[model samples]
Target: MTDTEIRAGIAEVARAHLGYEGELLDDTSLVEALRLDSVRLLTLVAELENHFRVVLEDGDEAGIEHVADLVAVLRRRIG
Candidate 1:
């Protein structure tokens, strides 16, 4: 899938899982905007991994700070 498609999927997951209704702009910070706590953030990561069929390394988790970061990770995994 393309980056746009991956981003949209991630946004949908965020909306469903985090109750975020605002526009999911590329630069939107998930941590700041969605106010995701540790549990919710881990859930999001697990959901993304399941959806993309890729396992994210534990070290890479630190780099994910926002929807854009998630999208970038998904893009790399999907590709």
Candidate 2:
């Protein structure tokens, strides 16, 4: 998938998992914007992995603070 498609997929997963009703911007902070707790964040990560079919290493968990970061990681893995 292209970067845009990857971002859209991740955003959709976020919206669904976090119970967001409105649109999500690319740069939105998952913690601050979605108010996700640690458990929810971990859930989001698992959902993204399922969506993208990519295994996330423990070190990779550090860079994912926002939707943009998630998109970036997906892009790198998909590439």
| All candidates: CA RMSD (Å) | 1.4, 1.6
Question: What lDDT would each prediction earn against the true structure?
Answer: 0.79, 0.77
What lDDT is reached at residue 23 by model 2? 59
Residue clash pairs of candidate 1: none
Number of the top-ranking candidate, with TM-score as the measure: 1
Return the lDDT, model 1, position 71.
81
Error of 2 at 60 (Å): 1.2
User: Against the true structure, candidate 1 has what lDDT?
Assistant: 0.79
Residue-wise C-alpha lDDT for candidate 1, range 11-76, written one tens digit per residue: 777788778778777888888877878899788888878777898886776677767777887787
* TM-scores, one per candidate: 0.84, 0.81
Pick out the ten consecutive residues of candidate 2 with the lowest summed lDDT.
18-27
Question: Which tens-of-lDDT digit does each residue in 3-63 have in candidate 2?
Answer: 7888778778877787766656677777877677888878887888898888877877676
Residue 79 C-alpha lDDT in model 1: 74
